[model samples]
Target: MNTAEVLVESLEREGVECVFGIPGEETEALLFALRDSEVTFVPTRHEQGAAFMADVHGRLTGTAGVCLSTLGPGATNLLTGVADANLDKAPLVAITGQGGLERLHKESHQALDVVDMFEPVTKWNAQISDPDIVHESVRKAFKVAEYEKPGATHVELPEDVASEECDVRPLDRRERVRRPDPDEPSIDAVRELLADADRPICIAGNGAVRTDASAALRALASDYDLPVAATYMGKGAVSDADDHSLLTLDSGDHEEASDAIQSADLVVTVGYDIAEHDPADWNPSGETTIVHLDSDPAEVYEHYNPDVEVVADIAAAVRELNACCADLDAEFETDWYDDVRDHIVADVTPEINAGDPFTHRGVVTVLRDAMADDDVLVSDVGTHKMVIAQNFRTFEPNTCIVSNGLASMGISVPGGLAADLAVDSNVVAATGDGGFMMNAAEIETATRLDCGYTILLFRDDEYRLIADEQTDHRGEHFGTEFSNPDFQTFAESFGIEAYRPDGWDELRDDLEAAVESDEMAVVEVVLG
Candidate 1:
């Protein structure tokens, strides 16, 4: 079989249903190979959209989402999304077509050191110069990308090597890799720590949202009477509908959430990644004893020194802790956290008023109510992301997708496309003016693919997130404002139905209709 054919076979072995990217001259052989396989190749408007699609796909499926690109500019455009996946801990494999090896050493058209450029952002990356290793390389790519603490991995295939004839067969799919479980001593230490603390609080991170992990955590919280506060990326790690939920744990102008953390005697961080919330913000005094549980070891920092660490499969670790809960009838007083929970509930709870302006928090509240428990809402990076994290209530894990690692601005639109492709439930892409305009061209791609999802576009004609930051620091902001076209016309031009909802009544009605429909739609809300 040809090298490209072997690569496609390897991809098939990984159970890759779709590969996203634009077809280019260098990827001609690879494209033809995909054409002959069962894998559907989605061509997006831009390389960044392809990577974002793969990023969300991986986030939903726990498999490595695959994206392809040609050399140079295409690969560069693909960088932001790849970096997003890497930091967000979503498994993704990005494949790039390189120019012929013979001309790669010397500067040539579209021949840049893509492998080198991708090294900093990827977990692992390599270029395959030998046609014989195509199967091995592809297999390695998937393995590394899907490993624990998963992130992006890269595979570079030169055009000449892709076109070469080869006899090597694609590698047989190996058994699923199992993450290591924590030892008895580690579990014992965690049990002891939990038993001693009277006002212990648990912080859930993105890693804690796996179906099994969430189940275990809920049981642990219920049995031990622990309040779970989710990091922004960790929203829905514990359902907001649950009584033990603290809604969201963040540091900012919100005194209630911060006060809750400050009063916490012991912080049990499960699947926590410091990237989502800095340790210093929560542990400014450096006095609270911390318990770390995750797939990876605790990241070393001045503010984050764990008294006990149980590093293993996060679900398994929590399950072990739950089993230990039987040893002690740990009944920490829950009354202290009640006001914190009440404040959060009242904060996100929307009040419809005729005189009120369209607020970001209100949009999130209405949208959350409109969505089903299993539905997915992808939040693009912006001020609205902060609002959603603080106010949006998600009942299930991965239901609310936020790009916090790289926290790229233009992810929501393309992310919605991936979320739709990954799940049977309804998908929504929440974006503000700046973020919407960045990847708005993907409306055409979604329409072309016949993907059904809603684009919840909020327009304020400015980069209000940055503007808000400037207002905090310098007391004024500049160059953070921008303009926009009528998003209704923009979506309609792409052959999709669009709605500009006037008020709360229209917005709630529009949201229900858009989500229930089987065709792509847009609901544009002006946040003036």
Candidate 2:
């Protein structure tokens, strides 16, 4: 069998149904292999969009998402998005084509030091130089990408390796690799810690969400009457509508969350990835007994040194903890109820209504009014994401998607694109002017792909948060302000409808119309 054919078989075995990428000369064999298989390859306009789509696919599905790229610039373009997955701890397999080893030392025309370039970002990076090792490499790459503390993994295929013939036998997928499950002693220790504490808090991270432990997480938290504070990636793992729900802590501004974390005598951190949260110095104070649980053993000591480290599948560990903790009658903290409330009150960064009457709250209110209960809203990183994090409330879990960890700028458009593709529910993206320009190319993609959605651009003519932070720090202006093209005109350039809202009422009307419209629409709110 051909190496490409065996590679495609392994991908299908891993349940990779959708691949987002653009074809190139180097990856032609892999592309042909994918075509021969049951998998559907989604050809995107740009490699960046492909990576973003793959990222969201992995995020929504527990499976590792795959994105393919060609040699040189094609592979290089994926670095930003690959870095996003690595930093954000998203499950992604980024496959790229490479020149053969003989061309490596010659400084070949399209050759670059791809392995070194991706080393800093990917959790594991490898190139398949020998046809004999290609099958095993593909299997290893998938496992690394999907395992605990999941991040991007790369597999570079040399042109010769892709075209080579081999008597390849697919590796035994079941026995490839196994993550360490929490031992009996470790489980009992955590249960004992949770059972003894009067006021306990759980900080769930990307690990919890990736492990699909939400049900177990909810059961355990509710049993103990624990108020849970989700890091950015952990948002909506438990419903915010729950009575014991605590607001998501902005990792960037963790003043009150830190205070809450310090106040607790026992902190049960399930799948808590410090990469998703700063946790200020990456360690908890000595006063608190921390029970650290995750699937990746490598993550246990890098940040917080826990009193007890339980390495296991997050869902299994949480489920086991729930079973053990269920027998104990733990006292719920009456005082801790007020602690989360006070933090929510203090964390507000009030924006003055000195600019446009279309306030941030007004925008959310209009969106809430028009959107269905299950309709999903994806937001990019900016002042808008924070505003939505604090203000825009979701009726259910997984309804709100934000770039909490990486906090990348160009994510909104591509995130919106993925949401549209992943679900039939109405999708919308809230982005700032600076972030909107980053992936503005997707406006045409949205129209071409018929991803009927709404785009709201907060046009303040400057990075509003940077401007605000500069005013706080330097007290004098620097290079924060810049001129921008009219986004409404730009949206029209993509053949998408554009709406210019002069005031709050007009914005409300436009949002309502955009929701019901068959085509993609952009509503630009001009902020003074």
Candidate 3:
């Protein structure tokens, strides 16, 4: 069998059912092999879209989603998406075709240092120069993709290697990857710390969510009357409506949550990577005892110094904490709960009102009002994402999707399209003008894929989120201004229906119609 055949077989075995990419000379062998197999190749208009789709697929499936593209520009286009996957710790595999072996270091046509370019952005990277090592490399890539704090893996295939024959050796399929066990002393130490604390709080991040530790988190929080706070990607890990659960922190109300955290005696951080949290607002210090639980040992001591570092699976660690805290009789603090509730009312309630024309708050309200309870929301990076997290509430988990850890600009459209396929729920993408233009070409992919998702474009004259912050705080607004294209016209060029809402009334009306429309629609709201 050819190396391409073996690679395809291995991919299918690893539960990779779909691949998104465009055709190129280097990928001809793999494409032919994929066609012969059960794996579906979703041809997208651009390599960037392919990478974006792979990201969305990975987020939805909890498996390594694969994207393929050819050499040079194809590889370069996939970088932003792959970097997004890496930052968010999404399980993705980017397979790029490199120029023929004869062209290496010769500056051949369409040739560049593909592996070197992708190295910094990926968890693991390798070029399949030897056909015999392809299986081992594929296995390694998948392993790294699914490992603790998952990220992207890049595998480059040369033209000759794809065409060369290789032994089709079957690899062993393990039920699950073995994670580090929590040292008994560490668990006992944490148990003691929690037992004595009067007011304890748990901070769960995307790492905890990815590790599927929600049930244990809920139990532990409820047992100890602990208030729960999730970072952006960690939203929906605990139900937002739960009495003990607090939604993603509102920057507008940072002082409120900050006050609560400061007063708390015990802080249990589960898979909480401080990288995703805002350093400007959050600080867990002083007399607070931090018991950190993480799947990755490396991430434990980076930000907060933990009194007890439990390097176990997030679920297992939470389960242990629940067991340890189950017997403790904790008194209820109505005053604390009341304070948090008041903060929610003061900080969050006002934004929900039908807001000012062209403001971020207004755009989110229009979307929240338009979507059904079962509908799904995908947000792009920048101010819109933070606003969406703080304002919008989902009925179920995985309903609100965003590249939280990575905070990639061009993620919403592809993620929205993926959400359209993964769930029968109505899909909507909320993106800024700068973010919209980044991967705006994917509007066609949404149309061609027949994804009837709504693209809500916030057409502010510039990158107001950064520019406003810079101007107001730094006395500078350099390189943050942007002139935007008519998103409606751009969407129309893709043969997709487009809507331009010049005012609040038009926005509300057009948004409602777009949601119920038969095809994908980009509702462009011109902001003041």
Candidate 4:
């Protein structure tokens, strides 16, 4: 058997169902092998879109999502999405084809140090120099990518190596890695702290969502009558409909949530990552006693000193904490937080008007109403992301997918495709005009695959997020505006249905139609 075949077999053993990428000459051998393998190869218009699809697939599934690319420019194009997966803590495996071994030592067409190029953005990376090492390399890539604090990993297979004949078999699939339980001492310390605190709250982060600890987290908070706030990516860690939900923290913009955090004497951060929200924003003085609960140890920061760290499986840790707290009759003074919850509910409740152009909140409200509670909503990076993070209510974990860590634009479109492939529910991909144009070509890919999802384009014709920031900081906006083609025409050109809502009622009807339809469609909502 050829090395490429062995690699494909290894992936199949790892339970990889589909791979997203654009094939090139260097990847001929691998492509041919995939053709005969059980794994499906989803060809995308661009490598970036393919990587984004892989990223969302990983985010939705605990397994590593795979993306393939050829040498040089193809490899480089996958960098942004791969970096997104790394920072966003999604399990992703990026496979790149390289030039023949002979030419790799010197200058050659489409040849560069791809392994080195991907080093900065991946958890681990290596070049497959020998055919015998193909199975081991592929196994290791998947293993490392799907491990705790999951992120991106890379494997480069040279043309010659892929074509070489090898007598090798994939390694036996090992048992699932078990997470260690939180230490008894650490759990006791946290229980003691929570029992003594006057006002304690829990800040849920991306880690909590990724670990599927939402139910356990909610139980802990509800049991102790504690309020819970989520970060942008951490949205839906607790159902926004919950009485204790403080909605989301968009860099401390929500005054009520910030006040609650400031008033709290002790903070219990569950699966929190500093990258999503800075500690200094809430605990500027570095004086709030923090109980850090996550799979990994806390990252030291001036404002994030943990009084006790339960570094273990987040779900298990939360369950243990709840059990211990229940025994101690732990109850928090949460009457003061009722005002914060009321303010959050009022802030997110949308208002409707029969206006020429719809406001972001109005559109979001209509869209949210149309979608099922379990449906996925992918938010592309822009001003609309901020609006959705603030206004959109998610009832379940991973129902709202926002690229808060990498914060990349143009992810929602391709990410929607992945979301559809990952789950049984419908998907709604929302993006601003500027961000939509970044990966609009993926509409063709979605159509070709018969993937049914709704794309909501917030037509603002500008980089409104940056423009707003410019206006806020300098009192002027520049270099942020641009024009666009008719979105309906653009979408229809790709053989997808399109809609342009004239008013609020029309938008609500269009969204419902799009969701009920079995074909890919785009709804252009003019945002004021």
lDDT per model vs. reference: 0.88, 0.76, 0.78, 0.89
TM-score against native, each model: 0.98, 0.88, 0.92, 0.98
**Candidate 2, lDDT over the whole model:** 0.76
Tens-place lDDT per residue, model 2, 251-346, is 225556566777777778877776667665424444467888787642544346677888887888888877766667566685765756565644
Candidate 3 lDDT over residue span 1-528, tens digit each: 998888988888787878988999989999999999999888887888788888877776678889999999999988888998888878899999987787786978999999999999999999999889888888888888878778899999998898999975647545658576677898889878867877777777776678778877877766667787777777777776677766665534465555666667877888777776753345533335778788865343333666778888889888888767765555535356557746663565454334565777657766777888767788988778778887675445566778876677878887787777767768888898888887777777777777888888877767778887888888989787768676667788888888987667778899999987767888887776
Candidate 1 collision pairs: none
Regions more than 4 Å wrong, model 3: 170-172, 251-254, 278-280, 284-287, 298-303, 332-334, 351-355, 372-374, 474-476, 502-506, 516-518
TM-score result, candidate 1 = 0.98
Cα deviation at 476, candidate 2, in Å, is: 2.5
For candidate 1, the 10 contiguous residues with the lowest summed lDDT are 250-259
Give one digit per residue, the lDDT tens place, for model 1 in 355-381. Answer: 678989878889988999999999998
Off by over 4 Å in 2: 32-37, 169-181, 250-257, 281-286, 297-303, 342-356, 516-518
The candidate 3 region of ten consecutive residues with least summed lDDT is 278-287
Writing each residue's lDDT as its tens digit, candidate 4 over 374-472 gives 999999998888889888988899999989888999999999999988999999999999888888888888888899999999988889889989999
Whichever of 3 and 4 has more TM-score, that candidate is 4
Per-model tally of clashing residue pairs = 0, 0, 0, 0
